[model samples]
Target: MAKKQTKDQALANNRRASFNYLIGETYEAGIQLTGTEIKSVRLGQITIGDAYVTIRNGQAYLNNANISPYKQGNQFNSDPLRRRKLLLHKREIAALDEAVMQGGKTIVPLRVYLVKGFAKILIAIGTGKKNYDKRQTIKERDMQRELGKNLKNYH
Candidate 1:
């Protein structure tokens, strides 16, 4: 059997998303990309840090995601920052739209990875975290690190 890959081996991850937003439900969506875009992604030249998802006309689109042009793609390369369409079911789109409209939630890209040789994106609904919430997160993380260090020393 082949070894299974984990989500941490993603091509690109928005590390700040967790600190800045209280992430809710997450969904895996397929991305429509061109040949050169996929080449760039395979090279690990993508950034989802500032990418966001928006639903329009019942379709979800990824915006502001930067996939650097392939070095050897020449004229075949498309715009690096072009908006890419997300492939999601009609029911998923409807639910996401409703959540955004009624729950005041935002959709953000969490990570991008290749699954079964296809490019996929992980997106999540999130509520923006306040300044104090961010501080608390930092404090908790620090405490966890300290506790781990002490435990390691005792062991």
Candidate 2:
């Protein structure tokens, strides 16, 4: 039998999530995807930059995530921006709901990756940062870069 190759890597990343919000705790959850959607995702044609998690009727759903239709899916392709259900434990869902309602935190998708031929998403609880906080982060990053360069010159 031929050995099957497994590609364990992130298909899409929300790089702006860190810059825009202070992420607290993270949870890994499985995503329910259609046939065409999964095929498109495997081809690296998904975007989660503006995606967020919301709880409805005790179930968690991913909103605003775009998974482009598979090129060869023909008429079986689903809507690109359709809300997808997230597979998380009941306890986890309750915890996230409590955090959002009481703690004033938001759920954001950090990244989407493939593990063991299944799609998984890393979700986090985050609080939005103020304008000054963003500026401070940029300033600190620049300073760190400069310091690293200065230290390299001394070696």
Task: List candidate 1 segments past 4 Å from native.
Answer: 1-8
What TM-scores do the predictions have? 0.93, 0.92
Best by TM-score: 1
Cα lDDT tens digits, model 1, 1-155, are: 74554666898989999999999999999999999999888778999998999999999999999999999999999998899999999999998998899765899899999887789999999999999999999999999999999999998
TM-score for candidate 1: 0.93
Error of 2 at 12 (Å): 0.7
- Compared with the true structure, what per-residue lDDT tens digits does model 2 show for residues 1-155? 73332444679999999999999999999999999899898788999999999999999999999999899999999999999999999999999999999866899999998887788899999999999999999999999999999999989
Model 1 scores worst on lDDT over the 10 consecutive residues at 1-10
User: Candidate 2: where is the Cα deviation over 4 Å?
Assistant: 1-8
lDDT of each: 0.92, 0.93
